[model samples]
Target: MRIKAAVLHASPIAKPYAETRPLRIETIELDPPGADEVLVKIAAAGLCHSDLSVINGDRPRQIPMVLGHEASAVVVETGAGVTDLVPGDHVVMSFLPTCGHCLPCAEGRAQLCAPGAAANGAGLLLSGAQRLHCDDGTDAYHHCGVSAFAEYAVISRRSMVKIDRDFPLVEAALFGCAVMTGVGTIVNTCGVRPGQSVAVVGLGGVGLSSVLGAVAAGAERVIALDLSRAKLDLALSLGATDAFLASDPDVVEAVRAATSGGVDHAVEMAGSAPAFELAYKITRRGGTTATAGLANPNARISLAPVHLVGEERVIRGSYMGSCVPARDIPRYIALNQRGRLPVEKLLSGTGPLDEINAAFDLLDQGKVVRHVITF
Candidate 1:
């Protein structure tokens, strides 16, 4: 089948992506789903910073790859040995395809599945197959086994989680990444309890989702920080007790002073050394500093081991919010349905795939939160 998809031929592309047009919208060949795979028609795909990271070469992947990992889709067909799902089922794609027998999967840590990680790094499906090809017979790589920025995709069954048919697909796209990472970091990784003070650095879709997670978890103080005042205001409206500009030199002091020393937990979602450092500095003694941001591979943070020993500080890395998608996606969706998550507020707007470059420009400029490219 031929599908309209976005293909990146090279990376480290210069900015003003609207003009550079890094992602070429081309009609490409999509193969049928193989065993343990399914064909899905994409309904919505979100423009995330992680995708931006690839565009700017922060997180490089194989060239000639179709780059989209967060999306919601409808099952069009199921391949051999796939019995759990059927055609017409609404589902959300998980960036990592978890093989149930893997060590991490057996340990209930699907986010760390070894096979999934290897497959993602190699730009292949869990089945070790390449399903996308170009007109010139060039093979295109899958982005985290999803490659969702297209009209349709053939994905491993392990890469999708079935959702209620009625859940809005546009909103469902967020659960795949932003909601899972943001809310999962607080609820699953940090286990933030009621009345605890929490600070979240960065105010993108994921960071703001953390704000919602903190408030929903009953955090007495949900502090939000970012370079954009607009995002700060948005966070404040989403139940954050205080909002501060991350660029403020005294931001750490202000947060510490307001929280009566510091917050119990501080999460870095900005994917930068400076943001991680800020999160670490705002953590109270004996507190936890967690980072879920996927920073540049070369990015490094400076930390004092003395603080870890003397202050008893705990620093942890969170991937996919340390969530098991099969269990957590529905749990988070339930929260959304109950009106507690209110993830709808995060939608900046929607656009067609033809305007994808412009949409990316909006995301790169910090002008939008979660912009969905509707198919």
Candidate 2:
């Protein structure tokens, strides 16, 4: 099948992406779904920071790739051996394709599924097949097994979670990555309980989701931090109890003074070394500092060993918010439906696929939270 998709032939493209136009919207060939796979019509896809990292060369991936992962789709066809889902079923694409039998999957840690990691790194379907081909006849790589920037995609069943048809599918795209990672990191990884104090460093789509998660978890104080004052104000409007300028030289001191030492759980979602440092510094004694940010592979942060030993501080890495997609996506969606999560407030706006480059520019400038490309 032939479809239009935003394909990145090269990375580290000069900024003002509207000018360099890193992603070329081109017609590409898509193969039929193989056994254990499903063909999906993309309903909506979100432009996430992770995708921006790839465009700016911060996060490297195989090039000439269809660059989208956070998406909601409707099943158009099911491949052999796929019985649980049928055509017309709405679904969310999980970036990691969890094989139920993998060690991590068996242990209820599907986010760390070994096969899923290998597949994503190799840019192949979980079954180890390539389904995309560029105009030049060279095979293109899948982005995190989703390649969702296109109108249609052939994905492993493992990469999809069926959703109720009644829900607004456009809003559902967020659950795939931003909502899952941001909200999951707080509720699942940080385990914020009622009356706990939480501070979220970074107010992108994911970070703002953390704010909503903290409020939903019943945190006594939800602190939001970001370099952008607009984002800070938005976070405040979304139930955050406090807001701070991350660039403020005395920001850490201010946070500590406000919380009487620091927050119970500090989450780093900015995907920067400095953000992690701030999150760590603002954690109360014996508190946890968690990071779900996908920082550049080469990026590193400095930490004091004494703090970990003396204060019993915990530093944990949260991938996909340490969530099991099959279990957590639906749970989070339920919360959104009931107005407990209120994730819909995070939507910056939506546009057509042709304006994707402009959308990326908006995201790069921190002018929007989560912009969806509607099909």
Count of clashing residue pairs in every prediction: 0, 0
Q: In terms of TM-score, how similar is model 1 to the real structure? A: 0.99
Candidate 2, 335: how far from true, in Å? 0.5
List lDDT for all candidates, in order. Answer: 0.95, 0.95
Error in Å for residue 81 of model 1: 0.6
Native-to-model Cα distance after best TM-score fit, residue 230 in candidate 1, in Å: 0.5
Off by over 4 Å in 2: none
Q: Could you tell me the lDDT of residue 225 within candidate 1?
A: 94
Q: What TM-score does each of the candidates earn? A: 0.99, 0.99
What does candidate 1's lDDT look like per residue over 212-234, in tens digits? 99999999999999999999999
Clashing residue pairs in candidate 2 (N, C-alpha, C atoms within 3 angstroms): none
